[model samples]
Target: MSTTNEAALSLAGVDKIYALNSRKPVHAVQALDLDVRKGEIVALLGSSGCGKTSTLRMIAGFESVTRGSITLAGRRIETLAPARRGVAMAFEGYSLYPPLTVRDNIAFALKSARINATEVDKAVKEMAALVEIESILDRYPTSISGGQQQRASLARALVRPADLYLLDEPMGQLEPRLRALLRGRLKRLLNERGMTSIFVTHDQTEANALADRVAVMEGGVLQQMANQTELKERPANLYVATFIGEPPMNVFDAKVEIGERVRFIVKDGPALDFSATAFSQAARVAIARRARAVIGVRPHDIRLGAGDNAAKVVSNQWLGDQSHLALDVAGKLMVAVAFDQVNASRGEIMRYEVSSTKLHVFDADSGEAVSHGAEAA
Candidate 1:
């Protein structure tokens, strides 16, 4: 909440709907509302075609909204030309003029701001150094590495006297390690300059690492907005819960009376609530609501107990740091995480243990979480 207005850029009830040649209409962004506070990084995240790009473009003044308004530092800019929006943008496609040197390109923004030539030179030099492109400042865009060229493109965006910075999949084409490295550096640059930014990315991990808050969208509709902890632990809806975590949230179904404590019953498997009273009053109220509420527990929080590896581990997706185990239980899926010695094989029955507090409960009908006790009650 603090971040939105503090954000240099914001979209207040912004809407974008497209009407094809003669067919029906497709809503690109549905009454979307968001704020990218000054000095804060907000990530607009969603699957492909889920409006993440559309939303970013609108803020950059690249796309016009069919309805709703756009505001930057309290001034409306929805109908303004992209060049007059006072917003800097770095997107997947390079907008750099190939003939210009890195220094010249970085100075382009300052020139447009009516800054004097002397000051433009100083700002361009500073921005070039910040993005590690100073060495290539004199080189033509065609001569630089893709990464360096992109860095220059980014530096150019930063040189501008804009209220907000919009990054639309700016790292989309970079290698993984480089992407990770740039993400940290880019975030630092924004902070050092005290600039507000709205970053769009489909990678949840990236969003988690870079943003002060993340906004999740699906089918042109925003699902939720929150910090990393809230997004991962207290997702408002099932999609947010499932979309934010890596190896994802291990889930199972159970039904119990309110105030009753019971580990989800697994046929011949270790109980998630295997340790009695280790559970909580809220969890009981949660399970009873569903007649079968889904129990979601993160992988790292679970383990194959002693004799716990007895249940058959039917499916496993190994990804270096951890392995995702999918065990079959009474014709349902029971996922778990094994850290140290992952010696179990597929269909090899294994035992598991889950922390009571770590278990997440969700409504069966709405797919939203039945968390916070009151909802469960």
Candidate 2:
């Protein structure tokens, strides 16, 4: 789906294997494929051991790829050394030299590249200002706080221009407030400078805030890659639908009947009539199978006292801007968001409805999106 000629970085059929002593080789990454376009920030997002770090390491040339190729600016570089690949990397471990001051750390790459002293100094100052570490340029690595050290590492990686930039959880160690601040600043800086960047992060907030596109990975395989809107509103599968949102999407198994009126029958719960809603042909065919299917709806899509579903309030939590209601529909627990202040008590029966367009249909057995609906949802 990406043009190699226009890409800043591309990976095809990439794999990484770790050998054990008389044991099966662990496949850390498998048949991974990705393309990061020029002047865009793409986030590699997944939980721990999901191979995000391994993928970044492979691209950076710190780890060798067992198979496949990596390309930077239309040139193959999987087998190239890190230095020859012309990629800058900032690590979570803050791999700064202990003896070097923050200013010197940032200037090292430029100096090594034979850039003049005045130019290197100017570049260091500019990078430090961009990362908000200019005041601490003289501090040693051991003298600064964890957050400062992270900024220093980022400054060093971004000080010199390169074909690509790889950042491994660069903000994972920072406080929440600082992380939020830096996310905005980093995104602005990258966009303004027209830099191509790939950052690995397990935090969905970080991905949503900073990335132009997000590649979601699980068990060494890429599940989906799309902009935040698509990933949230039209997930490729159940993993992505549930994985990308805060409070997550609520999905429940049900039996669908495509008779005179389309209906969803919850096991032991009330049946829901969706006859008024028009479904896709594929969705109709999938429903005709009458097999087990799941219905996914975002918390905001479930409205109280509005439609064809009923649930008992299990708990009510009042967040500042909204409220979270935990409901028990038959034997299953469902979460719904209420925009207004709610004073409903536990055990109270609440009637709710799901918006027709916001519904996500998936095959219950495979956990794959049956409809793969449009973005307006």
Candidate 3:
């Protein structure tokens, strides 16, 4: 890991607990340390109610920390007011004032910053053009497309010079096609501006696409935080494994042999053997115990065979560029990414093959990766 950061923002041992005395006191965030370097976009990704939102709120000073500190450009800002921290935020639910015109909405932050009137006007016009909303400056939020309105909201946050940007699911209001289009634009905007951004979203695809680094959170705890390639190639644990991929990594019980002709023992069936290296007797025994060694492989790693054997098709979902086929490999559903056309049907028995080298093995006992050293990659 390159331990260098001309860091724009850093968090060390941060925690947050809301309504401490209440029966349902939410342990929203805990013991988190992260660094966002200059010109990078980092994502706090997880399902709803995970620490992603709470962490962003804490960083933005909208929520008080139960413990730890936040620093901006090397200055501790935990106790600073949100505005004093030089932070800007765009959120879900479209927080723009409905009555204000697009131009006025984008200019609100300039007014709050006490910028000169002429400069604020100039800034407003520039922002309007940047967001492609110059033609709709007089239009109210109700009159513009939700996509345009989201850009207006985004433009509003960019009006003032700030140390960090906190975006909480800003694309939730737009349609799918527009969301995709805006995602690319948003990425380019942040990259070109060299902004330190923390974006919160549960959308895995968006998180994967936009972040320079991904911080995976779950149930108020961080599961893993690393570059996209590292997280996918070497997951820290099963939680991170299941959360980061599209259609998800396929997981099923199996045992691995660390010897010649390595064997994969799936419950209630014969062992699928593959050869070469890496697998020890001790490792195999350990994997067998979680009474279930989890074998997780990505969709593209599974090969669709021409005949019925140990697998059968369950469903074929036509996902634009590719047809994703789900199959019943024993009881666990296995998926295949047919790079070409898919013409399979339910209950049709077919031969299925797993790319053993591309397989992911987990300790059935702890749900952690088993092969370490050279095998882990």
The top-ranked prediction according to TM-score is 2
For candidate 2, write residues 70-101 as lDDT tens digits.
99988899999898998999999998999999
**Candidate 2 clash total?**
0
For candidate 3, give the lDDT of residue 125.
88
User: Could you estimate the TM-score for every candidate?
Assistant: 0.85, 0.95, 0.88
Ranking by lDDT: 2, 3, 1
The RMSD of every model to the true structure, in order and in angstroms, is 3.6, 2.5, 3.3
lDDT of 1 by residue, 1-377 (tens): 13434546667787888883448788889988886677888888989999989988888778888889888887899999997888888866767888788788888777766889999988888777766676788899888778777778777877786788888776776678877887788778777767788888898878988888899999898999889988876888777877878767756555534433454553444344434355455555455545656667776766565533345678877768777777776565767776655777776767765555666777766777876222341
Candidate topping lDDT: 2
Please list the C-alpha lDDT of all candidates, in the order they appear: 0.74, 0.86, 0.79
Report residue 340 deviation for candidate 2 (angstroms): 1.3
Is candidate 1 or 3 superior in lDDT? 3
In candidate 1, how many Å is residue 341 off? 2.1
Q: Report how far off residue 247 is in candidate 3 (Å).
A: 1.6
Across 1-377, the per-residue lDDT of candidate 3 in tens digits comes to: 22246888889999899998899988888798888898789988999898889899888888998899999987899999887898999866567899899888988888877889999999888777766678998889998887787778888887778889888887777778867877887787788778788998888788888889999999888888899988887887788888878778887777565445666787764466665444445544454444456777778767777422367678888878887987776577777887777777788876767655577778777777865322642
Q: Can you give the lDDT of residue 237 in candidate 2?
A: 84
User: Clash pairs of candidate 2?
Assistant: none
Clash count for each candidate, listed in order shown:
19, 0, 3
Model 3 clashing residue pairs (backbone)? 258-279, 258-280, 307-351
